[model samples]
Target: MPETGSGRRTLPTVADTEAFGRELAADLRPGDLVILDGPLGAGKTALTRGIAAGLGVQGRVSSPTFIIARQHRAGDHPGAIPMVHVDAYRLGGDLDELDALDLDTDLNHAVVVVEWGLGVVEHLTDRHLRIQLHREPESDVRTIVWEWIS
Candidate 1:
């Protein structure tokens, strides 16, 4: 879990994608923003589920597409950070809609993960972990490339 700066991984299954997320979560903390960029069926929500597990947050982790966002409270652990999972695809590049989510405020106490958040949510923080998941053609494999942008 050392900050090696950046790395990429190939996941052959959905479980592998989530496990990779758990490993990545070891390096995360409150006030951290993680932007997941990818197309449909890229396993972004699955990855977030792993992150939520690693963070010990309570609640069922699922895609927030319909509601746009979902908040998962931290479990019984003292000082555990909460999680706010958001789907920015529906925003349609609307800054006003993005601002309404008030993600910056959530960053004060939770780990914010946004699917399809690449260009839209970067302004919420000066630094963020950007992970891109790309599904291979005609296969279940996914390639994840991640880096910390400051």
Candidate 2:
């Protein structure tokens, strides 16, 4: 919460992964872009659930793989931050496809979380939080590394 910069953390359970997300979410704000890089069955979605929870967005938070992107409005709640969850796994060679979502329009008013968005969404912003999650062999635990670029 004190702008700790970049570091790594190990989560032993699904809940732990989400909790870690909540912890990381403490410093998030509108226009924040979080790129989650990891393999299938990794804790990418789980961590995003925690982030959405911390943002005070309503409704169930799930992977938007099929739909590609899901917008969670902050509603009438004062101080609530809106969220845009995107799945870049299905994107092709051109990330310019992201242009169709019009993310730039509300970027200053929403938190954008993209799964498998490494090389795909870097052009969105120069400042962002990059989180990479990796699963341990035969273990439910996951190792998450984070970097905050300004």
Top candidate (TM-score):
1
Q: List the pairs of residues colliding in candidate 1.
A: none
- Model 2 stretches astray by more than 4 angstroms: 2-4, 75-78
C-alpha local distance difference test of each model: 0.91, 0.86
Error of 2 at 88 (Å): 0.5
lDDT of 2 at 104: 73
For residues 1-150, write the lDDT of model 2, one tens digit per residue.
545389988999999998988777778889989999999988999999999888888889999989999999885667778999999888864556778877776587999999999987877876888999999988889999998877
Tell me the spans in candidate 1 whose CA falls farther than 4 Å from its real position.
none
lDDT per residue as tens, model 1, 1-150: 654478889999999999998888888899999999998999999999999988889999999999999999999987556899999999989999889999999999999999999889998888999999999988889999999889
> What TM-score would you give candidate 2 relative to the actual structure?
0.93
lDDT of 1 at 85: 99
